[model samples]
Target: MLKRLALSAALLAAVAGFARAEDVTDKLKTSAAEVLARPAADYVESRVEIKRGDATIVGTLTLPKGAEKPPVVLLLHGFTGSRDELPIEGTKEGVFSRTAHILAARGLASLRIDFTGSGESSGKWEDMTPQGEIVDALAAFDWLKTQTNIDPAKIHVLGWSLGGLVAAHVAAERPVVTATLWAPASNALYNFSHFLGSEAVEKAIASADPDAVIEIKLPWGATTKLKARFFQSLVTVDPVAAISHYSGPLLVIVGTKDTVVTPQPFAGESFLAYHDGPEGLMVLPTDHAFDAFTGPQTVDLMAAASLAFIEGK
Candidate 1:
């Protein structure tokens, strides 16, 4: 009789667990439907100004309608990219902007900011560094915590390319609950060598003038310049080492064809370093930007994947 009672109790517990799971799924579906039923413009949008030392970082904060104290995601852009990311000329939506809107529709709020020297923010591009950007990100986090409509404990950070590196460092040092990296450049020195070539990098490192500019010509014929200090500072930061400090939930999304960051060595290294927490990796057939070779569908796929991870689904 005791054995039969124990079996019955086990069966009851299983049924209760199943019912709870179904209830959560049903709520998610309802939230998604409500988000989809409304247009992007229907969401409440606000301009945010965060003070970082002498400079003011500018950003946009978007919230889903009727969401009370919703979880928020902080979006960070890549090198030479702004808060809007590199918007595809005809459309105003870049990866960050599109992702923010989609997340908002799904009952999530997002804040995408232009790092101190990038976009409309007040600073010189030549003066921006990885450390400085990390400071700006932390400041943004502090600002977000002050918002009455945002849940401070549920803040998530997502970054692409250089921004991804920044996001990792911020997650390690801050109280971030989760972090997502999209084609994060794992090695700063390697990237400098890849873009500027070994000879140029060597010259920049040996140069006595910290302010000396190294002009690198792009494949498209335009030339961009970086200060000597930028390369010098990069040599001090190991992205994998920085990321290892964070034991929270991590999600890494990379492209198989991403010649920019390269998936082989660093991608594997990044996935293995987060040994203390839950980690996920997704590889797409797209390029570094995830939309360079594919259509707009790539953005949708990225948003869906990211939302799934953030929502714990």
Candidate 2:
């Protein structure tokens, strides 16, 4: 975003020193790609669509080379974000794009979709709800399982922010291999109530008008209209409980300055307390979006950790 190419290169080179030992033994050693900034190669990408009722969920499916049936990772973006997301403001890469390429380098396939209404998908923003997102995520999972080339049993999910909440429910519902959440909003009501004031949402829902929509400004200074149902989902979805039902390993990544899902390590720590399984939590020193405003160190740390975890390393 703020031209961190120099910083990314420096940190990645230093990190490479730590991987020298593994490079000699590991089957697919880490690539030469500089910290989450890499072009799409060694993989094949295609446009894919999933049907949810009358709406079409558009996505980009990435299939990595080397593996005859590569394992897949479902990449879920944060709230109000698209499939590839905002590209870190200035760079040509966003979170999911880097994740897809990095995983591809390690012989892992990925599918990043525009969850209904937010990206290239067809739906109204006012009608978007957590429950609906769960439905869409499950539909994507179902579709992925039917694909001819990908390994059906090794599919994992990686979600960020509010999408983490949806990913939780999706993992709980599906027989996923592993579940990874980056800066997840497990306590939906608590997190939204702090950012999206509960008073205004309650008032809009109480209105007799069925078409009632209220305009609220996001923390990033953008105003958006929301229907009453979207607010109700804040109280309805329980991702913490959902995580408990998922039998696979869980990885929760967060930063110390994550104001959206505040209190840092504790918010992440709570996620493991509810679940009984192999779990990991990576806490960085940057903000919610993994050092979007700061340098790329935190993001690099997270990307490395996520890759290792998903690779079962």
lDDT of 1 by residue, 1-313 (tens): 3543453355345334321111123333344344445555446888889987789999999999888999999999888889978664345687788888888877889999999889999898887788888888999999998889999889999999889889988888888888888888777776656655656776778889989877766645788777888878888876677788888878777777777775333453454354357776666667777774345566666776777777776
lDDT of 2 by residue, 53-164 (tens): 8989999998886668888999888888889864654456777887787778767899999889888899987888888888889999999999989999888998999989
**Candidate 2: 10-residue stretch with minimal lDDT:** 19-28
| lDDT per model vs. reference | 0.75, 0.75
Model 1 TM-score relative to the real fold: 0.84
Clash number by candidate, in order: 0, 0
Q: Estimate each model's TM-score.
A: 0.84, 0.84
lDDT of 1: 0.75
Model 2, 161: alpha-carbon shift in Å?
0.6
